[model samples]
Target: MSQAPGLGIPGILHTLREYLVFYSGLGLLAGVSLLWSVLALPLRLVLPRRWRKQTGRWVITMGFRMYLRALSIMGACHFDLKALDTLRGESPMIIAPNHPSLLDALMVISRSPNLACIMKSELVDNVFFGAGARLAGYIRNDSLRSMICLAVEDLRRGSHLLLFPEGTRSNRLPIGTVRGSIALIAKEARVPIQTVFIETESAFLTKGWPFFRKPSMPIHYRIRLGQRFDPPTDVRGFTVELERYFQSALAEARLPPLSSMGARAP
Candidate 1:
């Protein structure tokens, strides 16, 4: 009798509602993402090229904030952005973060506000993000040479760049091998290099993880600001050093959940 629902049908209904909230929030996120691209079309036409990108980024930032808030409200997940305040107003720097989950970009972009990233080429034509991303002028990672040149140009123009040194989501625990492109970009742009360590308890949205199966409710995410380095003339050496730095950080970054850690909100 103790294992049965407290109030029979009402208790069962309550349990079902709790289980469905995450799916509902997921649906809302998808709908809003699609709507944003459609609504941004007019803005693209009216604003100048640079202004379009700036305005588009702000719009997307606001949308992402709202999206995160909505999920929080629905008891889906929460974000703990540590040391993110140190990056405020800092520009023309290369932001290198470990790719632990897909939510990493959204979390970082929301906090950085004006930062741009080298996005996948497929996203350039994605129905939900195609037009908006193009208007934002995000670099596509199709051609390495062209992408690096464009990234350096973006930095010179006072725009901060968010680069994932691991290139893609890590398949195993201590992070995967980093690409040399980040070093080349830092070398050519002559900008400061900052590493961000993303720590997560859940494995959802990782390399082969499916979206339908939700991780235990209220999935947690925390990011800590790692070391900052001055640009080095030696690109290859810098890449190797940075890779080792990340390997160590991820290995030792075994932190408790945000609630227990008493982390502050972003």
Candidate 2:
């Protein structure tokens, strides 16, 4: 008797299908990002100094939006945003958010306009985005002292910057720990830090997990902007006060509190 046509097709066909889908998704993401990055380069020279700043911000925002779109398209992940209305058009403010997923930066940038980010040195050196980041003038993560100074100057010039108080992505469920750097920056800049929290259900997109597998679903995010805390005359005193403010805010937000994290006074 002749062997059934379907007898051995399942194994080989399944493997080939998975590989094709995976590589095709990768190629599509890379191609689109390259085009977006190339198109954004000219704005650097065409725009005026003041306009240059805004244009640079737009590039970063667009890059992030593209990244999110690619994720949604390839991984079948849906994006759900909440409480963005509170942050729209707000500037010269220090944005503090709880870091839970790798995509937190993308989400924040995608929603905000003309916002500067405090990024790690490694990302600045990344082949994919280093060129764009340099052109955009993102504050380097190294040299905390210098970064603090730059942040203060940016705020004075009516520019907004984002800071992850945790200083890194959290590994725990609720949140890991918040660094004192944010509190110090708020104090020195004499501005308020807008607190936010993000929550997601997909393990693939969770902190430190970037690989896409098994079509993902829409993930939920919760963003909270707490009442602003004015800077105190004494910078050291202000740091303590601000840290306490964040701790309380986190607690109220139903996330992990930072009181036990031992935030240092400036």
Candidate 3:
């Protein structure tokens, strides 16, 4: 439950050591990613455009899984992702999750191969991620109208779309303010929205949280599926209610259930 720890000199050494491994692993993965992206370029020229997109997405999905697993093997983090894997139904619904850390997208996308997300316009031009993202047909968050249209079309085509309604990582506990775009996407697409809860014991990689100042080793992360809802006709009201649900979820997650609180006979 402690977001940050104060562990004097030992803490500083651990932080530095963990960050060294983190950056080294990140660099290695980035190189592999770049290579994969460049190699996929030929598929664009040879295969049908649609087939190329699918293949590119598959590559991205595999890469993500490998990257996360490598981090786990390196003793950087461990994940509780069983609940998230169960949410991967065949239906094309919106995946709305709270953004606690930068790795949230990687965690979600690794499990859903058919998922495309709304990413920052800058990433589309990023040297390492841009090529892969473009080849995978990920949407950019530049123009709202275009983004909505693309998202709806993707859903109609049976592709799952992931959205972080908060728009950015949480700056405080109990999640941050949710945006209306998620509701708008659901209403326009007429698809259900599935909420996913990402619980982390540490605030590493959160907004303004220094990446090098790592938390305790093998940082714990858990993904539990929240309630799924059909898009209501009232977009504004639905958005407000959605935000409230996430707030309650965070609060409830912090408390023990009544059944668990009772004494047990030995």
Give the winner by TM-score: 1
Candidate 1, residue 11: how far the Cα is off, in Å: 9.2
Clashing pairs in 3: none
Query: Of the candidates numbered 2 and 3, which has the greater TM-score value?
Result: 3
Model 2 has an lDDT value of 0.64
The models' CA-based lDDT, in order, is 0.80, 0.64, 0.80
Model 2 lDDT tens row, 1-266: 11212436785675555456556755765676566456546766666766666766777687677766765665434566546556777766887777766667878888887677889998877656655665666788799898888777887777778888778866553555556677677777777777676645445445545355432233344555666655546655655665566566555443322222332233
As a whole number from 0 to 100, the lDDT of residue 207 in candidate 2 is 50
Q: How many angstroms is residue 114 displaced in model 2 relative to the true structure, after the best TM-score fit?
A: 1.6
* Runs with alpha carbons beyond 4 Å of true place in candidate 3: 1-19, 254-266
TM-score of 2: 0.72
lDDT ranking of the models: 3, 1, 2
- Candidate 2 clash pair list: none
Candidate 3: deviation at residue 50, Å?
1.5
Worst-scoring 10-residue span by lDDT in model 2: 256-265
